[model samples]
Target: MKEDAFCEEGDIVLADASEDVDDIGKAIEIVDIGGQRLVSGLHTILASRIDHRIVVGFGAYLYASSGVRKQIQQRAQGAKVLGISKTQLAEVELAYPTEAREQQKIAHCLSSLDEVIGLESHKLDALKNLKKGLMQQLFPQDVA
Candidate 1:
């Protein structure tokens, strides 16, 4: 495999194609490689920062931003499976602060918010399950 094909820390792997239209162009940034050789699979776009302008961890969230997502969804094609070519992917412009510090701050804030959201979601699921159990015990089903 070519060296460029391998994913490294800070690289963003984007889903260029997916059966679900909402999933088109979704991306994930590789924060750590863990000493493993990682490569994006078929139907993915491997993106790496050519310069230090865009800080690490920014690309993943940038693609998820409203404007970028709208652009991606608009450009997505096909009936059964949506897809975007390299050129199409490139056409989705991103707006970011020119300052590296600003970019870092934004990425950090978003990451922290994501962590909180995950914790809250788990708690919500647990509460829902508890409520379900309570309801079942309170009102038993009549056996036929």
Candidate 2:
């Protein structure tokens, strides 16, 4: 792959193809590449922050937001596999805060919320497992 193909920190990569229309334009922010040459796959659209209009960690949430997703879904066209071209993606309009500090705050808050959700999900799973164990103990299966 060419040097230009390698992605850098804070770059956003979006899925261009998916069987589910709602997932066609899902975006992921690359926070780290582990010091390796990382490139987006053929099925993804790499978007770099060249103009610095949107701050880091914000594009992922921006693209995932309902407003931007609706535009992307409307632009997507396909029967079996939904797809969004670079042109169509470019046509999708998005709004963001002008102040860099505001963008940072939004990203931080969202990211912190995500962390909390993940922790809660883990606790729920553990409780479910404990319940299953208690149920097994309460009603043991008969052995032939």
Candidate 3:
């Protein structure tokens, strides 16, 4: 079975203890539907702000201030997973800004970044194709 087969939507995931732990602490939101025992490749990072209690999904980063962590720990008592209940998921406190306009601005900035990254990727692909064509012309090879 694929590694993802074990995960379900809304389930808090802990990185496999055996894998590299660098990006293991972050939680991810599943965006695709898979079988009861199937794994999927689509996921987004779950992030929240401490002072402002704002929960958001990020592309590759998740953040929670120390205060948020403490709150989650306090509430995690008796929280059971597969068969264990431990303070594994970090807690985050989020606060919504009173001004809707400001919130929109923040979201816009992040969206802009995503767009820029996508455009840059396309440009890189075009450049690679151009180089391949040039190389083929510069050094034509014949097969016998």
Per-residue lDDT tens digits for candidate 3, residues 26-137, read: 4444434455553423332223233333323321222333443344434443323211123344333434455546655665676698799999999999999999999999
lDDT of each: 0.87, 0.90, 0.44
| Candidate 2 overall lDDT versus native | 0.90
Model 1 Cα RMSD, 1 decimal? 1.6
Which model is ahead, 2 or 3, in terms of TM-score? 2
Residue pairs clashing, model 3: 4-39, 5-38, 5-39, 52-94, 52-95, 53-93, 53-94, 53-95, 54-94, 54-95
Give lDDT tens digits, candidate 2, residues 51-113: 788887887888889999999999999999999999998998888898889999999999999
- State the RMSD for candidate 3: 9.4
TM-score of 3: 0.45
What value does the lDDT take at residue 29 in candidate 1? Answer: 87
lDDT of 1 by residue, 1-144 (tens): 899999988888889988997889898888878999999899899988867667888878887898998898889898998999888888888888888888899999999999999999999999999999999998889856
Clashing residue pairs in all predictions, respectively, total: 0, 0, 10
| Superposed model 1: Cα runs more than 4 Å off | 142-144
Clash pairs detected, candidate 2? none
